[model samples]
Target: MSEVKEMAAKQERQALTGNEAMALAMRQIEPDVVAAYPITPQTEIVQIFSTYVADGLVNTEYVPVESEHSAMSAVVGSAAAGARSMTATSANGLALMWEILYIASGTRLPIVMPVVNRALSGPINIHCDHSDTMGARDSGWIQIFSENAQEAYDNMFQAIRIAEHPDVLLPAMVTTDGFIISHGMEIVNTLDDKTIKDFLGTYKIPRNLLDVDNPITVGPLALQDFYFETKVAQADAMMKAKPVILEIAEEYEKLSGRKYSFFEEYRLDDADVAIVVLGSTAGTAKVVVDNLRKEGIKAGLLKLRVFRPFPYEELKEALKHVDVIGVLDRSDSFASLGGPVFSELRAAMYDMETRPLVTNYVYGLGGRDIDLHMIEQAYRELLEIKETGKVDQYVNYLGVRE
Candidate 1:
């Protein structure tokens, strides 16, 4: 414990924006290859990393691709060749990689991506929102969300380990809200190069496409006969990732003195009303939870850090005690019922013996501000639902004019 504490004390604390933190982490990792196309919010990440490559700060093979689709394809090829590979993108950029996203995961390449969350384009908006990543929720990649620059940095280290683990050889992405965590500066405690290298060890995949002596086909066509079994294997791998994620997080805590879990619980143990949220909004919700607690309102918060394996069972256990819960979403699902996170939470709690009243609040679309007042109102509404034992509407939009 003393050694761990000493190691933590030795870590350098630096002021950086979320994109810079991610870039620094990548630099320390010194991945063999990086293929990315520039996109708003996420552009700075690749831009900074490219400089590292040019200046010989890191011996990385940087590939400037034409589009997000080509970028992902390039990463897939590099990773399949058993090289550590990564990329960064946001919004429409992620949308462009939709096809390759599935291919990377399907082929079980451990490619790490930093998806700076931005609103998906249609009306043409470039701002903080989960719509981009949320749209790719079913793309078979491990998804982790960060609330601040510090978390974004830390999660980047964990993501590489998580994705490359033998039991969980799948693509993984770390997400930070665009222009919120991405562009905003904050203090981040970063591990030294040696510590990070030792912690991540070496990039060694069990199998690779480039292995000529013992070769195996990747992404081969499987029509109906073996497709189901392959999918089962993928599902099993995802299930196995839950425990691996926890184990890696525990080890990370030992190195950095910063603990992490699938979801962070803030005063949720004995609360009657709670709000659940993701990304930067969790910070605002935490402030509201602290204020409400001071007022003896019994309000609490559940901030989801991992959204991929969904943490269904653990989350169900965490929120089991609350009487009423508000699930906040930065992007709507357009299903008319609720947003992505909200719908998932509802499904997780559906089988519980005594379920709490859960409502969905879609807020902060197109980078709209989600102030403390708005978060407080969500908690207040939860209180009302708890008292009346009735929810007028299951889905509600926050900070929007009706």
Candidate 2:
């Protein structure tokens, strides 16, 4: 079984949008089913995929669904039938697929989707925010966030691998920052088709209870007694996915020469203060970390690659040596005590024997520019928390004044 196919073609160079990189990677995987509803940013992903289907580059059924709900439903149906399936959607489209999203994971189908991270509508804006993705965090699917075009392209393959890992027979979502990374063109070094085919391998679904010859029931009418077990099984599978996630990432690094982990530490060693962030802001944070290091301020960064499992233990271990930690949340969980990432990090270190002073900073909401200076400001805030043992209750809206 070739987990990932090797590329024989000349190491070719091409300028492609992040959307195109997604299609190119999927072309390599050669999923049997792709059911998608078109939306801005994400639409280009499906459009390019449709072209791949038309050109005979990939042997698959591309379902042009009428809506995102049908799109997710189509993939679920195909997956239940033992097909390697894929899909893509954004804000409203993702919301439309909510019901089927759970069905996909609960039924234990390894479906993969690309969610162009965007803000949900009320006053109506198509801009980027995790509101769409955050709303579905409770869904059983594994969620992975990509910081740039390269990570987005790389994660497309890894998502399939992680989802289909026999122990993790669940759906997965690869979310790229809306417009900032999705629309912005960057050099994404895509692997050769054969290399990807070997990396992801042909999808082999478990002998599902759905097989007619076996005459077994699947997703049957569960009483309250068994419903608990069914959900517990799902939880167990997600928890077990942590190790498999790291293993797949390591394998990709070996095969593709691109290293990845649940989170990447930039200058964390010997640093007294570190700012943890996710998605595109990590790029800006890196610049800030570099400058701060030169200024003799031992600052560092933790860029989250996997958001669903939350990497709690790993996060604690990652920041074990730091004196102060700053968790930057791009999206606000206003109802919560602080931002989402901050809350999670706090919980991760809550029971630790020795924990660093952690502070939460909420920035870059609704496509706000997360500049390097704001990142520097966050580092300063964390330092103050370390020095005075105090922090602010209100989420700091970077680049904004009351």
Candidate 3:
């Protein structure tokens, strides 16, 4: 017989790496399976989780896969078998798992991955950039970006809920800044075991997939006749997921007192211009907005929290009041006329009869530093775009000396 041995209750405060925070979050949730490979800035997350399994903190299957492709494949298998499974990766590791990422989402498996957003290499650099994840943006999974360690931990908690929601039964990616957030240590207010358990409840194993008495086939090979309908079904699931994401975010706010939206608005209500950004760069933009406000200039930050199922309606409403909007794309979209995120936002607002003047400024490419002054420069560039009506085709590399 198994006994219920309890860990001592202690509300101890300490600084923790984003990877450690993510590990603790997974510990609290007690996933049924964890399938992952060792990837830079993401390896520590699974390493710590492995320790928990050794210590008996979590009774689960820990699959140490040979490669990232196998890791993601393991997750799809576990999730389809009706187990709550998770994985983490970055850069080349994400690139390797490209094929399975789509398979997991298309099959409507609720597996979650913490993508430590990193730059792809031509000459080889393992630093922060959204290039890898941005490359997979078209995959059917829901994507959520975290600005810092705390948000990284918080979003991990929410990812499971959002993914498992019946209407949103798709895989999800919770992204954090590579090396920046994943390696940086900070104070994180993690939920207690009881509180987290109450918040998440039991992982409601889906009846169709997990029923042992009624065995069913999953991932059945579909012919060309049924392929189109499967594609449409996946699209319908993603569209339904948007509201479920919002609803779960609201529920998380009620439980933890931290509210998130499709995009987080920082002092944008009265600002003449606001810079939009995702990931840790948004934190830099926030500080710049504060400093700009002190100088009596109306400036603000619009942080994109949800990148996939791109919150078009919510974003349209959020940017309704601003006069000029500057989008800071961390990842460049070559051949797209401008940066990736900016081009998407520009297209979203292009048809709107009453929309703010949108401009694009690309920054922080190849793991570059995005300081407050750089953000200030971006705001000024947007002002120029508004006044002169000229938007640059290439990105405005932040802090570059040219």
Candidate 4:
């Protein structure tokens, strides 16, 4: 009986949607505060979490703020007050919190936000896209993208540890594709509550605003004299977070038996053509890679899990041997050059000894369906590029009507 109980306590598998997984992770963490506003695709996360708060499953201070901007502001204040704070948002909700996003990161608050990746509004969209989070890539937060419900839950646990690490005191966010991952259900293995609590331990703020004994000033005005140095310090923290992220991932793997890194490589051991992507599209791309492999086409994939601390060196090393690389971006940079991932990847390969020919494929904007056929088309283009050593157009749009 004792042995059976111990085995049962180790792990539990259940079907849960991406939003439910995130909410469950938060419930397990038992954060001190969660201030969030409802947004499409992101509503279920907070809705489910609020029930935990109401039912007293977790002793959390649930702040039902009026707007996303206020929600983030409340989290910043709570975090500054030495509380482990978090929130969830998507699309325009994230846009409303743009100003506070900088404040939280600049103040070095270890706030964890779960972003349900959605297309930002201009024409007003409530669908899955990378525009929302990609627009805020430079906001100094440690950004991690999830490929499925399992990754979404796992990344939330990792995000808490990553943000709170003393060496990497920065805000972090875990993102999943809106409507797709957020609404779709999948089997997820979750650790016991006690195990999660043991792993997370306690919240520690090195220099919180509410530490009356030490009395520190946060977000003080420093015009030309000290602002530059402060910004540089934030930049340094972002750089330091990369190693800390990997270390925490190592620890997490021991507990969950799931391995994670900056990026996931699939069938790339010896490949001539490859595709680099993020979010749920990686899963689609992998299926396409498997099909191409069966057809004797050397194709591979590199799915980026971490975007902010953009794994430049690791990416360069991963793709150096490939003949051609296709970077698929869900959001357009509108720079006329390429999308965000494409621009960064192209720049990363600039100084490589044997750089692979890379091209940009912008796809799946405004919840556009990126089926296997579209992915296969992209791989076909890569094979052509590899053979010809020429790119008819450096920037191309996939699954879009001209």
Q: Model 4, 1-402: lDDT tens per residue? A: 564455445789889999999999999999999999999989999999999999999999999999999999999999999999999999999999999999999999999999999999889889999999999999999999999999999999899999999988999999999989999999998898998999998999887877778998877898999989989999999999999999999998888878899999999979999999999999999999999999999999999999989999999988889999999999998866899999999998999888899999999999999999999999999999988999888789999887
- Which pairs clash (backbone N, Cα, C closer than 3 Å) in model 3? none
Residue 96 miss distance in model 2 (angstroms):
1.2
Per-residue accuracy of model 2 over 1-402 as CA lDDT, tens digit each: 232333312345567777787878878888999998899768889899999999998899999989999999998888888789999999989999999999898999999999988878775777787888888888998999999888898999999999999999989999888899888888766667777787877888876545778665556787877888999999999999999998998888777667888899999988899988888888989999899888989999899989887789988888999998887887788768677888878988989999887777777667777787888888888778778876655456676667
Kindly report which residue stretches of model 4 are placed more than 4 angstroms away from their true locations once superposed: 1-9
User: How well does candidate 1 score on lDDT at residue 49?
Assistant: 98
Residue 146 lDDT in candidate 1: 97
When summed lDDT is taken over every stretch of 10 residues in candidate 4, the lowest stretch is 1-10
Total colliding residue pairs, candidate 4: 0
Please provide, for model 1 over 1-402, each residue's C-alpha lDDT reduced to its tens digit, 9 standing for 90 to 100.
687678767988789999999999999999999999999989999999999999999999999999999999999999999899999999999999999999999888999999999999879999999999999999999999999999999999999999999999999999999999999999998988998999999999998878999998878899989888888898899999999999999999988989999999998998999889999998888888899989989988899999998899999999999999999998897865899998889998998999999999999999999999999988888898988999899889999997
Score every model by TM-score.
0.98, 0.94, 0.93, 0.97
* Cα lDDT computed for each candidate against the true fold: 0.93, 0.85, 0.84, 0.93
Winner on lDDT (1 vs 2): 1
Task: Choose 1 or 4, whichever is better by TM-score.
Answer: 1
Q: When superposed on Cα atoms, how far off is each prediction in RMSD? A: 1.2, 3.2, 4.8, 2.3
